[model samples]
Target: MATQTSIPASHDRDFYAWALESANRLRAGNLAGLDLQRIAEEIEGMGRAEKHALASHLKILILHLLKWRYQPTLRSLSWQLSIANARDEIAELLEDSPSLTGKLPEILARRYPAARQGAILETGLPAATFPTGCPLTVEQLLDPEYWT
Candidate 1:
């Protein structure tokens, strides 16, 4: 059997405080939990263009957070700063890549079909007609060539 050590209550409280602060920032930016829920509904209703936009934003945010928090080598404050900087660089690449911009929604839809459907419906956008030009696909995003 595995034993678990209890974390101090103060540590839990501090963690909650930091999480709340982050949530507040997201809310102030119109990206609250409720807003995200609404966006999920909108995804089902959205036209292809709107769905694509939302998907792109979501991906960028996820990638940014991953880069910021999960870099294997960044254990110290300075390395963490480097992670943040790398996230920014990744953001820039996403913004500038036309191929990626087009396929964002398809990637999301394939990756999270239910959530994508809900978002389209909530956004009140018409059904999407995925264009042929988009470079990102459900498969491609999952197994990215660039990353490989």
Candidate 2:
């Protein structure tokens, strides 16, 4: 699908070339030009990206749940679908990285306030009405049977 080219000198200059070069070096057992430091850093960055994604999805899930709870009369199929989708995403993330289970509670706590704010912005609800702290436990939020 594409032409092969010489590896770029620096990873910063061309990331695609850098990755290809790194892989080629590793496969060829040529450690001389292999960027071990940058490769390790990139690996760690990928893990952090996944954690951030989990946090982001958790925030969105809680926001929709708050709206569903606080604005019962305004609930719609879209909100239902959003909650289900978020749960599904969260499950997939946990399945891929089960160590994240230990961080779930703290993540939920950290994201809850922002989620409430989002709920207010989206629903036109006053901030005073929502709980100061998270109302749903992480388990409850993740439970498919919990929402009615």
Candidate 3:
């Protein structure tokens, strides 16, 4: 049982304690004491955070791939490791949330410009060197062996 005074007091002072307290309350059938509003929002935020993480990893992976393709002479182990790591992370994310697969095409299209600009800064290549649109499809981007 949670200390009576610790219930509300711990919530504002220490988040971990608050979470533990909340779990205790929930498991003990003390729904009346839960901060359901905050818990609901946090749960919602978790989904959005996963989506954002997927998009971010894809962006970096695509950027490095553009650099790899456009600046072949400048390629190094770092880029190879980045692409491989990103692919692994993306695969793990998809394995956990297969539903997000449908969103990949949109995410790739939306994030391509950022990837292109990132490539420009890293490669010092003219912006015009990269196509105005993404050159690779989501399938191509995710393929481990597809290095152009």
For candidate 1, the 10 contiguous residues with the lowest summed lDDT are 139-148
lDDT of 3 by residue, 25-63 (tens): 888999995789987886788788888989999999999
User: What does candidate 1 score in Cα RMSD to the true structure?
Assistant: 19.3
lDDT of 1 by residue, 21-122 (tens): 555656688444334553455455445554455455445433323332333343456534443454454355565554665665655555354433433443
Using TM-score as the measure, name the better of candidate 1 and candidate 3: 3
25 in model 2: Cα distance from truth in Å? Answer: 2.6
Tens-digit lDDT track for model 2 on 24-139?
87899988867788899998998998899899999989998888898899899999999999999999999999999889998988888899889889988788989989989888
TM-score of each model, in listed order: 0.22, 0.88, 0.88
lDDT of each: 0.44, 0.89, 0.89
Q: What's model 2's TM-score? A: 0.88
Can you tell me which runs of candidate 1 are displaced by over 4 Å? 1-46, 72-148
Alpha-carbon runs more than 4 Å astray in model 2: 1-5
